[model samples]
Target: MLTDYHVHCEFSDDSVYPMEDVVRDAIGLGLEEICFTDHVDYGIKVDWDSGEEIRWRNGEPFANVDYPRYFAKIADLQEKYGDRIRIRRGLELGVQSHTIDAYNRLTEKYPLDFAILSIHQVHDQEFWNGEFQEGRTQGEYNEEYYREMLRVVQSFKHYSVLGHMDLIVRYDKAGVYPFEKVKDLITEILKVVIADGKGIELNTSSVRYGLSDTQPSRDILRLYRELGGRIITLGSDSHRPDHLGAHIASSMELLKELGYEAFCTFENGRPVFHPL
Candidate 1:
């Protein structure tokens, strides 16, 4: 079955595309299954410009998904499109070391088919705006990012997979941070993830960012395989209709070339694999 496990819709603050439009577009592309992993980034306080704590809508600075509305809409869509396509309710959680309790509570409170643990910011500083990389060399920021990931992975256990393991490289202003520079730390993070029965997603957004590589890169994929880690998932990380399911077939082909025989989908927090 062709499935895209990472997707964003209207529920995500950064995305303006309606959830229904995303589902319709996925159906048009012949996707059998798609997961709505909308963003839920709590603990983000800064404005990225003033470097001051922000208090926006509902007294929260960052855009956190409205769980009640999000889940209710997913239930309705799932019932409406059950015969046409499989829709899974999921969340892209921006995990921080200090907010583990909040995430734990949220996960326990909801019934999520899948959850992606992503590090969107470090210490409330976003990488996209260069706040996380300022005053630091590429190597330093790279190592810091990996270390933060390792710390969170070691502590948090609610997520199904780590989203875009090398996401920091995408926003690095200095240059592409070499894998060798942070491989050791990444290995540790991967080890913890595998040991805890978690997986990693092959985020296809690299093409969107003109990276010429997947989020974690091909070398990291090889290492994950070499370490006996096999729970892999493919996602376009698309925020809009046009990008939905983008590059998924190519990503599966690449995984097959790398000796990955199968990729995964989640339901009720359990993984189910399909041959590539």
Candidate 2:
């Protein structure tokens, strides 16, 4: 079964596609299931050290989320497409070290099938928010970035899966942060993720970005397997129709090569595996 867990519809601020269209595309791709993990980013604080190069807005980050309407639409899709495909209600909550209370509240209030906890912004500056530009050395930038990600993983423990472990490298056009060089940092992050019993997602979006084969690289995948990190999920992280199942075949092959015999899916907060 092809299960793409991390996807966004118009409900997410950065995506413009409607939920119905997203469901249609998934069915066309021959996927068995797709989960709509729309953005739930909240809380923004400016960092003075980031200086003038940084230009962005700050507020209750996902203040636009209309919970009543959001859940209503999800219910509509569930009834309309119930026989064809499995549509799971999910959310991608942007979390920092201090946002644990808020994160817990949102999770508690919802009947989510899965929750993808992510670290999008760091040290009061959003990674994609234009605060950190492309000129800095990858080592210097990724070190700081990974450190904050580790802090987020350590602080927030309620999530079912860690979304895109190395997503900070999304904008590293230079490809300077080789996985071998940062093996120690990556290992530390993976240890915490596994120790906390959180699953890791193999987000295929990195292929579109022209970066490493997978978000965490082959080395990280191998390490996860070696460390007994059993719960793994696969996703296209698709926002548009055409990209619904992007690079998924290659991602599965990578997992097989890394010694993983199966990939995972969630229902009512319990994981089910599909054998390779």
Candidate 3:
């Protein structure tokens, strides 16, 4: 069945597409299932057009979702269209070392089918905006990024999969960070993830960004498989209708070439594998 496990809608601050519209578009594309993995980044400050901090309920300046509303919307959508398409409620949690407690509390409070733990920022510095790489050599940034990922994966256990394992490469201003530089650390992270029964997702946004590789790259996927990490999922990381289900077939073909016979989907935090 065709499924896209990483999608964002109005719930995510960066996405303008409404939930209903996203669903309708997915249906039009003949998708059998899709998971809404909206962003929930704590401790990261977002600036408005005027450069003002976005505050939350407690008046803390951070980017996070309204859990009550998010879950309610997902529940409503599930009830309304569960038969037509399997809508799974999920979150793409932007994790940091210091925010683990907050993330734990949030996850405990909500019932989620799937959760993607991602490092959108390290030490509160966002990679996308070039703040995370300022004054640091490419090697330093790459090492620190993977080290931070290792730290989080070792401590945080609430996620279903690691989203975009090589996400740092997408925003590195210096250029493509060599895989060999951080391969050992990434292997360690994958080992821990596999040991803890967690998995990783193949985010297809690389093509969208004009990159010539997947998020984690084909080498990382091969390494994960070599380490006995069988649990893997495919996601478009689509923030708009046109990007939805993009390049999923090519991703599947790549996985198949790497000897991956199936990909994973989640329901109530449990993984279900489907043939590729």
Candidate 4:
């Protein structure tokens, strides 16, 4: 079955695509299942109904999903269109080491089907704006990024998988860092995740982003398999209509080629694997 495990809609701080329109688009595109993994960066962004001011990045308002409204809309859509498509509630949780308690509180209150634990910002500094990379050499930044990922994976256990496990490469101005340099850290992270019975996400946005490496990089995936980490997921990481369901088939093909037997979807926080 065709599925896009990572999706965003109007609820996400960085996206403006309404939930209804995204659902219709996914159904029209012949997708069997989709999880709305909208953004939630607690420390840097406020909740939509937090009664505080909303922040904007480059003129786009950034706020965490208004959970009450977001889930109600999802439930309504599920009842209305359950026969046509399977819709699952998910969040792309951007976590920092200091914000684990906040995430635990928020997640405990919801019935999320899936959650992508991502390190979008470390020490409250974002890589896209060069805040995290500034005042540091490429090696310094890259090492720091892996260190952060390892720390989160070791400490946080609420998420289903690590989102774009190697996302730092997307913003590395010095070009792709050598995997061998940080292979030990990456391996340790994967080991901890596998031990914790968690998985990693294959975010296909790398293709549209024109990234030379896969979202988590090929080496990471291979290493996951080598470490006997079998629970992997496929996601387009879509924020717009055109981005929805992109590269899914090719990603499956790639996974099969890499000897990964299955990809996965989630329901109630448990993985349901599908042949690659």
Candidate 5:
């Protein structure tokens, strides 16, 4: 009855869990269906020099990921658990606004059941490597981040859902670019995403890390709804087995309170609603 649209496996440069563990965890959590959206970022440019920390090393923006191996593993899991659980194959493609041609190559290679197009890198920089937090006024940094993210949404025509709307704010500890400062921009971003027929995700990763109530928060979600942004997916952005279905109850409650009657789920790449 519950589903998590975002999960990562060893194929991702950051995650280390084998596909079996991911499937096992999903089963344990009673997830009727779950999607393993492995990393599909190309040319993200990380510090490929010196002995980097494990988090940075394992999760450094880019990797020579084995796509064939990834698909094979997913196929194996799908067959292995076909009766007990519904395992959906998916990928989270990192988007760089200017690299549509490369992204086109990726789409050509892998036909995913679902695809999450995210702005993990901006201005040729990686946010996960902590590079996005480097010296700059917090306000300036967040504005720049959101602007780049909006550009990403506008430039790409692919992707089933927009992973996390205000993901850059996860780094804004000082409340610098407060929701108010980014309200208009957030509205515009949602307009573009909705107009393009893409969905937004209520990523619970922010809650797990104690960063914020949700990745985009109440204000943004409300704004999104008010602006006619309907399709919304819920994901933990889980990189490990234990994190599967991390905060569905809480996130669902938040969505209902925000006046949303349903959350979006996908079946064969089509949006379906599960009433909240």
Candidate 6:
């Protein structure tokens, strides 16, 4: 079955594509399922009731998803289109070390089918805008990012997968850092992920971003396999319509070339495997 696990629509701060339209587009593309992984970055964005004004990026407001409205809309759509396509409720938790308590409360409150743990920002500094990487040497910034990631995985327990395990490369104006430099830390991070029964995402957005390879890179995938890590998930990381399910088939084929036999989907926070 073709499923896009990392999808964001109007519920997200940076996307204006409406949720229902996203479902319709997925169906038209012959996808069997599409999980709505809307964004909620606690440290960078505020909740709807926080009484703070939202910041915007390209006309879209930067704020956490409206929990009550988001879920209610999903429920209505599920009942309306259950026969046509499987719509799973999910969220991308842009987690940081100090924001664990906020995520803990949100996880306990939502009946999420999946949750992607991503380090979109650390210490409220964004990688995209170079705030997190400012004034630091390439090596220092990379290590610090991975260190925060390791800490997050060790302390956080509510996510289904690690979103874009090496996402730092996406915004590294200094160019891609050598993997060997951070190999030790990545190894530890993957070990903890495997031990906790969590998976790592292969984000297809890397392709649109004109990257040299996949978001996690082929080397990372190979390392995970060598570590006896069995679970992997494919996501387009799509915020716009044209990006949905982009390069998914090719990504699955790439997984097979890397010796992966299956990719996964989630239900009630547990993985369900599908052959590659």
Cα lDDT tens digits, model 5, 141-246, are 7887778778877877768888877777665656636677877777788889889888888898887778746777878888888988888988999988668899
Query: Model 3: residues >4 Å from true position, as ranges?
Result: 45-62
- Candidate 1 per-residue lDDT, tens place, 103-187, comes to 9988998978999999998887889989988998888888888888988998999999999988987887677877787878888
> Which residue pairs show backbone clashes in model 1?
none
Stretches of model 6 off by over 4 angstroms after superposition: 56-58
Score candidate 1 by TM-score against the native. 0.94
Better of 3 and 5 by lDDT: 3
Total clashing pairs for each candidate: 0, 0, 0, 0, 0, 0
What is the C-alpha local distance difference test score of each model?
Answer: 0.87, 0.78, 0.88, 0.93, 0.78, 0.93
* Cα-lDDT of candidate 2: 0.78
Query: How many collisions between residues are there in candidate 3?
Result: 0
Per-residue lDDT, model 4, residue 222, is: 92
- The superposed Cα distance between candidate 5 and the true structure at residue 232, in angstroms, equals 0.9
10 residues in a row with least lDDT, candidate 1: 45-54
Lowest summed lDDT across 10 adjacent residues in model 5 is found at 46-55
The C-alpha local distance difference test score for the whole of candidate 6 amounts to: 0.93
Show the lowest summed lDDT stretch of 10 residues, model 4: 55-64
Q: Candidate 3, residues 1-276: lDDT per residue as tens digits?
A: 889999998778777788888888998899999999989877774423225567664433345666677778888988988889999989999999988998898789787899999999899998887999998999998999989999999999999999998888888767888788788999999999999999999999889898878878999999999999999998999989889999998989999999999999999999999998
- Candidate 4's C-alpha runs over 4 A off are none
Question: TM-score per candidate, in order?
Answer: 0.94, 0.88, 0.94, 0.98, 0.89, 0.98
lDDT of 6 at 164: 94
Tens-place lDDT per residue, model 2, 98-136, is 777877877788778888888887655677744764555
